[model samples]
Target: MASIGPNEIFFLLQGLKWTVALTLIGFIGGGVFGLLVALARTADHKLARRITAGYIAVFQGTPLLMQLFVVYYGVALIGLDIDAWLAVAIAFTLHASAFLGEIWRGGIQAVPKGQTEAAKALGLHYPSIMKDVILPQAFKIALPATIGFLVQLIKGTSLAAIVGFVELSRAGQIVSNQTFRPLTVFALVGLIYFLICWPLSLWGARQEARLQTASR
Candidate 1:
């Protein structure tokens, strides 16, 4: 068996770029789509609300691994020839959107009902009301949860390996197989993940504290 060496470590570190890329794609796509979902959930129309709720249910209820499988293989079965990276990106985006939508929905609802009423009393349109008043407050409430979800999303990218994306976890698996050092390889993988996630968790906590203090 080959020994784990500098080259092996560098190879694994290279996977970090894909991990970071996937996280960015997931968060950016999910955040935009999720904002729409949150708005629909909060809309006056019952049909819109129900549709967004169902979307959230299906994505959030299922395992992300299954979602990735469906996106990767199911698309291939349809003859689209989607890239594995694209497939992983799409699946993670949908997965992250559902959870984010729910998080932001709660944040929207948590805003004082009177604020909405007051906006309407000022004869503001729905968009204006939301844009100028409700969403700002909701964003503050949502920031911590959004950050938390993003951190989880980053960790969850490890699941992309299941669909053949050789990210950090997959790199570890490969290194372990070659070096016959499963424990050491995976411990290093865990440490890398910790290094990425710990700072985000701390930032989220600090933001949450600041929001609470501002609220009070």
Candidate 2:
């Protein structure tokens, strides 16, 4: 036991704040970017769709850890300050955008063709058709998956610690380094993650159930 105390627990708990904050930053930033990607992918322009597809493929194809490393060290190589928070935020946003864009694209396509035809008959343009006719119904289908993605995003924040972000997992590492108790520290950290994610999983399931009922 290497001097574990209330202060140490407090330190770890404080790091939890960073973890939650970083998760939100990634979620919101990625969510907006993802919506754009999804829209672009579904656009009429073949070249635009292809370019967006390539962007998604590259990000989704690579490991997120490598992306994190690139963000951390790549910016440093260019003589930018590139703080841990900004680096982690940008990396996770790009990562989340790829996955979320795909999720949302699936939802948009899942909408019935009849719906688009009906909207077109109502004199709606593509943007208005998507906004007024498609997105509303599609969002119902999207809710469960989006919530599930949020859980993944939260868990993914643990990776931020790898780049010295001092979030939850890093807090555990610091504690483990001092106490030499990786199992206990990491186990507690895992439990904390579970506490955050399990409820989200349940909520997503419930959302899916309700949507199914409504659609039927």
Candidate 3:
């Protein structure tokens, strides 16, 4: 068996790079879609609200691992070829959209009713009210939760390994198999994940605290 060495370490770092890249793709794509989901959830139209609610429920209620499986394998079964990276990206984006949408919906609803009323009094349309007055404030309210969800999304990228994406967890598996040192390989992997996630967790907590203090 090969000993853990610079080569293995470099491989792990490369995997980390992919992990970060995947996280960003999921976040940016999800953010765009999630904004629409949030808007639909809060729309005046009951049908829009119900449809978005069902979308959120389906994604949120399902296991992310299963979702990844369906996206990665199920698509191919339908005669559509897709790369593992694309499949994983699609899965993560869908999962993140559902979660982030729900989080932002809460933020939107938490905005003071009087503010919406005041916007209406000023002859503002629904779009203008939300765009100018409601969304900005809702974003602030949702910032902490959003960051917390981002941290989750970062860790969740590990699941991409199941679909043959060589993320951090998969890299560790490879190194462990070659080095015959599962403990050492996984310990390092866990540490790397901690280092990446702990700061974001702390930042989220700090943001929550600040919001609480401001509200007082």
Best by lDDT: 3
Q: Return the TM-score for candidate 1, rounded to 2 decimals.
A: 0.94
For each candidate in the order shown, give its overall lDDT on alpha carbons: 0.93, 0.89, 0.95
All candidates in order of TM-score, best leading: 3, 1, 2
lDDT, candidate 1, 163-204, per-residue tens: 899999989998999899998899999999999999999999
Candidate closer to the true structure by lDDT (higher is better), 2 or 3: 3
Model 2, runs deviating above 4 Å: none
Model 3 C-alpha lDDT versus the unseen true structure: 0.95
Per-candidate clashes, comma-separated: 0, 0, 0
Backbone clashes (count) for model 2? 0
Where does candidate 3 have its weakest 10-residue lDDT segment? 1-10
Model 3 scores a TM of 0.97
Off by over 4 Å in 1: none
Against the true structure, what is each candidate's TM-score? 0.94, 0.93, 0.97
Error of 1 at 72 (Å): 0.9
